[model samples]
Target chain A: GQQVMQIPQYQHVQEGEDFTTYCNSSTTLSNIQWYKQRPGGHPVFLIQLVKSGEVKKQKRLTFQFGEAKKNSSLHITATQTTDVGTYFCAGPLKSGYALNFGKGTSLLVTP
Target chain B: EAEVAQSPRYKITEKSQAVAFWCDPISGHATLYWYRQILGQGPELLVQFQDESVVDDSQLPKDRFSAERLKGVDSTLKIQPAELGDSAMYLCASSFGEDSVYGYTFGSGTRLTVV
Candidate 1:
């Protein structure tokens, strides 16, 4: 079975500090998608990385896919209070239409 | 923008009672999924449906749980004889395609608590 593992189960940082979460998969993935869920909300899609060694950015958030397609990272520059949420990385299973999600990294930004 | 829809945002029932939740996926999406998220945990896939046909349900507790996506548009998940451990958030998500590049849109989940 394929599994995605996320590092730093929890993180707390000042509003002006930067934060990063890493996701590693047991096997190479075809693609990876990132999502964010507020404290009591449904998960929302953020971004997806399909190409190996690819990088994408959305304002202060940066996402990267490793060349081997087995890991990914999300980095937030100068975190904000609105950035408080759980970040998840999901990958499709080899034989199904569903996805396997990482445990997620819960981010807490303090002002 | 289109969004997935779910009903009964919250539910509370006693143990051994039957409960159900409903979900309506975005139009034109081909894949629908049901996930369960325990408190402080990631969403775990319970079932996957490609239109009206179920693709996978290995993680679902078949002895007590069942799901259906009839007509390929709306879905329902039911639990019979629910236990306290069944308390969690049930999320429904839909994607346009099978590829991970096509991200899914999830509906506000149904939080269930079996007392």
Candidate 2:
């Protein structure tokens, strides 16, 4: 019933270039979480945003939640080869047990 | 660091065969979830369990997919008459809480290839 869509399905950049991925949901979410999955690896938790228009930063990465709670974005400044992976944004399911994940934005950084 | 445990990191089965995957969540974690990720998509929920009780399984294909957490400590997912479309990575994740506030700790996942 609910859907989350991610923009820029794929991206490739130089080692020092910046990258951004956007996620939009069909329904308003109470909270949103970000995850990263390396090639041949499982999804790893990155960050979570709850408040309206909230922004959280971890090292070189920044996560932002839209004011309406229907969208979110992740930005990386000066990406590196190690930053190559698929980034997914997940919203809490209304029933409150599982998360609805966006398709994901795959980032490839070249040297 | 504690991590979720999954068995048989990979599986290859013939179409119309049966396959199963196992998972053991971190100690003391009450919530467990099963998700499937295709080649280029994010993980999608298949089922969720809370201490041996199923909280939801609406996305699971009941006709061919079944999951159980009998003791609430470990779980198993079975697919009968697996089809080519069932090829994907099956992920098992756990959280200390029932909601996303704590986020999830995912296992390496079982990559299935149906021939």
Candidate 3:
């Protein structure tokens, strides 16, 4: 069975600070996707990285995929209060179509 | 901005009672997934469906949990004789394909509380 691990289980940052969460997998992944779950809200789709060593950006956020497709990272520049949520990285299982999600990094932004 | 629809946003039941949750995915989506999320943890895949057939359910607790998508449009997840350990959030999501890299549309999950 494949497993995904995430770093910094919990992060509390001041407003306007930077935050980063890293994800590593026990096996190579075909693709990696990021999701955000607001307090008491369902998880929402954020982005996906497919190509090896690919990097994508969304405004103040950036996502990078490792060259080997075994890891990924999400970085938020100048985070704001609205960025408070748990960020999760999910990868598809090697034997099946279902996804295996890492224990998410809960981001808390202080006012 | 289509969304997956879920019913009974919250449920509280005693142990050993049967409980069920429903999900209706966006139209034309070919794949559906059921995930369980415990407090302070990420969502874990319980099962997945491709149209009317199940693609994966290896992690599903078959002894207590069962899911069905009889027509491939809507889904139901049922817990028979539920237990306190079953208290968690059950999420439903849909994608355009089995391996959709574009991400998925998730329904507002059903929060179950077993006492």
Candidate 4:
């Protein structure tokens, strides 16, 4: 079974600082999706990366896909308290259509 | 924006009792999925449905867990003789297609606590 792995299980940063989380997969992925879940809330779609070596941005956040499509990263600039949440990276399973999610990186921003 | 809908935002049941959760995906979505998430952990796939037919349930504990989407519009998940370990958040999601490249819309989820 394919597995998605994420680094920095937890992160605490000061407001205005930067934060980054990395994700890796045991097998090549056709695409990678990122999600954010606030405390006591459901996961919400953030973005998706499909092309190798792809890089996409949304405001202060950046997403990158490895050339091999087995790794991805999300970086946030000037983190704010509103950025507090768990960030998850998911990939489609090799056997089926369901997505396999990483343990996720929980971000905490302090003033 | 369309959203997936789930019922009984929270549930508390005694060990060995039965519990059930319900979900209704966004209209016209063809793919639905059920996932379980323990506190401080990522969501794990429990089962997936393409229309009313189950596409996968390999990760589900069939001995105690059962799910159905009889009419292909709404779905239900049941746990019989729930154990303390069964306590977790059950999430339901829907997508416009079978491939997740289309992204997913998740419901609020049901938080189950087995005492």
lDDT of 4 by residue, B1-115 (tens): 7889999999999999999999999999988999999999999999999999999899999999999999999999999989999999999999986555668999999999999
Give per-model TM-scores. Answer: 0.97, 0.97, 0.97, 0.97
Residue pair clashes in candidate 1: none
Please give, as one word, the docking class of candidate 1: medium
Candidate 4 chain A: worst-modelled 10 consecutive residues by lDDT: A91-100
| Native A-B contact fraction in model 1 | 0.75
Model 2 scores a TM of: 0.97
Give a tens-digit lDDT track for model 3, residues A1-111. Answer: 338999999999999999999999988999999999999999898998999999999999999999999999999999999999999999986745877889899999999
- Highest-scoring model, lDDT: 4
Q: Least lDDT summed over 10 consecutive residues: which range in candidate 2 chain B?
A: B95-104
Fnat, one value per model: 0.75, 0.78, 0.75, 0.67
TM-score of chain B for predicted candidate 4: 0.97
In candidate 3, position B80 carries an lDDT of: 96
Question: Could you report the DockQ of all the candidates, in the order they appear?
Answer: 0.71, 0.75, 0.72, 0.68
Q: Which residue runs of candidate 4 sit more than 4 Å off their true CA positions?
A: none
iRMSD for each candidate structure, in the order shown: 1.7, 1.4, 1.7, 1.7
User: For each candidate, how many residue pairs have backbone atoms clashing (under 3 Å)?
Assistant: 0, 0, 0, 0
> Model 2 in CAPRI terms: which quality?
medium
